[model samples]
Target: MSTVLFWFRNDLRLHDQPALHAALTSGATHLLPVVCLPAPDERTPWCFARVGPHRRAFTAAALRGLQQQTTVLGNPLLICQAPPAAALPQLAQAVGATTVVCEDIAAPYEQAEIAALRAAGLQVRTVWHSSLLHPADMPWPASDLPGVFTSFRQKVERAGITPAAPLPAPAQLLPPLDVPAPVLQAVGAEQGAAAIQPPAPPQGSDARSSFPYGTPGCDGSEGAVLAHLAQYLARKLPHSYKDTRNGLTGLDYSSKLSPWLATGALSPRQIYADLKAFERNHGANDGTYWLWFELLWRDYFRLLHLQYGAGLYRARGLSELPLAQHNQRGFERWCQGETGEPLVDAAMRELAATGYLSNRLRQVVASYLIYDLRGDWRAGAAWFESQLVDYDVYSNQANWLYIAGRGTDPRGGRRFNPTKQAQDHDADGSYRRLWGTA
Candidate 1:
């Protein structure tokens, strides 16, 4: 009987999981669902823990949800600690599996993992289902994608390119092979066994939080995200999204879907699909259209990663100019929300406390770091990677590079005047009062 190893990376949820569906329909007599946990102490080049406590907690919750769902489907998830390159080949060998299938990731480090698996003589098959639209469905090749967001958006809109409907989760997965506990334990030991802990109970909602991921019924699980989405739409929140999205506080200010989207617990196409239904039922408005617009921006960043590869991670970024010198002290202050700028400090404190920041505040703090602090943009990006519960590689890097004048921005870098931003977005001082001393 044929056996296949289905490695789960960022795409954690079973619903709308094309890769998972493909693995089930591949006719393999036995299938194993596996999640490779990152080393708890993994540190980045900037000496910051690559995965902070908040993100770790959020990821654990998502995995637990996935485990429960997979168990219900009769194929329990196998949790492992080694990186994909180290763990996958050993597991496949132990189980005598012939094929390894997973979702294709676009980031540099993740691409390296796939390369390592192929090098180990494993027949790896990857499905590109992470984005709203598949790369093949684009009007142009990723290599030839427009450099600017506006140009890309215009071309895609002109071509009338719509995302393919998402695939439903499989009803019944092939039962797991009876690999012995000793063999599994040996493989795990060779790769290092990283313990999976249950996520801590949420800290309850802060009325000042735009994203209350910590609130009850709003934890990082796929079920929580889907329920939250339903509640938002049920209340017709999308109708006011465009106008309220810039607000400094309040849960209704934005969709707050980034956490789920980042973890792949919620698929972009799934979001797009629900959005279209809402527009059909409620009649489309600017708010609804803006949500689609934002999704397109997400797609654009993913495409950028596909186009640039390692270039996106470099100090010089995509531009020919060299970035400013790294200022460790300035960056440290920024990370601690101690930059002495009230607005930036508040935003930073909010991120440090809640692992989330509004889209407007993200830009505001990013601009402050790159322009006002005159710090290396990469340092700030790494800090975000360390702190944000919803950090996505493409969007985080692309945004920092854009703000640093090293990306596709035609006008070069963006520098937001903190005083002006305070006046415009937080005119009432309520947001500052909440996070000022934090």
Candidate 2:
């Protein structure tokens, strides 16, 4: 029987997963589902763990949920410690599989992994399922994508481009291959093997949290996210999303779908579909429109990556202007939430305690780090990668570069005044009181 290895990358959910769907329908009699855990000692140029404990904990929770779902479908997910370049080829050879299928990530490191797999003489098939709108469905080619977001949005709207409806999870997946259990165990036992365990539930929801991912129905799982989405819509929340989205604290202030969206537990198209449904039932309004608008922004960032390639990762960014100096001491203090700026410190502390921050706070903190602290923006981006449970490579880097004036921003860069932001967003001082100290 022919077998195909289905490797899971950032697209973790089985639902709305085109890559997994392709693998399942590939005419292979058996299927192998694998999730690669990065080597534990992996470090970024900024000298921090590539995947920190907070992100690891959330990912572990997500994987446990994925493993349960896949196991029920008869194909258990294999947790491999080796990087894809090394482990995927070995697994393909071990299973006598000729083809490996996975989601195509447009980032440099991910593209490099695909290159390595091909170099090893294995056939690799990749499906692009990361964005809300499929690349082929875009109004213009990636190379011709608008440099300004407004222009992109206008052109897409003018062309009446809508995202494809999300695919449903397959009811029956291919049966597992007869690979030896000892061999699987040995593969997992290799150095950097993922130690996945269900994370401890959050002690309790802080009344002040904008994103309470630790709450019972809000945990990082496909089921949990879908349920949360339903509940949010059921409460008529979309009608108010535009008004409340900028709120500094409180669960109802924003959709809070980003964590699951980033981890692939939820799909952007899935969210878009549900938003349209809500509008049909409740009437279209700014709140509903803004949700769709935000989804477009997400797609825009992914498109930017497609257009710019490794340029997005460079120190000088697309602007090619020299970046600010790196101050190790200042950067360290900023990370620790000890910058002596109450609002910035509070936001940092909240992020440290919970792997979340409101979209408003993210900008505020990024502006503070880049403009006020005069720190290297890449270091800030790296720290966020290590910290945020909802971190997306394209959005994180693009946003940082925009704030640093090195990205697609027509205006030089954004520099938020910390004191004014505090006054405008936290006039009551509730947010600061909740997280100002440590």
Give Cα-based local distance difference scores for all models: 0.85, 0.85
List, residue by residue over 62-176, the lDDT tens digit for candidate 2. Answer: 7878888998988878888778887777778778998999989888988999999999998999999989998899868899988888998888889999988999999978987
Error of 1 at 197 (Å): 3.0
State the lDDT of candidate 1 residue by residue for 31-146, as single tens digits.
Answer: 98898888877999989899987777777778878888999999988888767787788889888896899999888888998899999999999998889988899978889999
* Model 2: per-residue Cα lDDT at residue 62: 78
Clashing pairs in 1: none
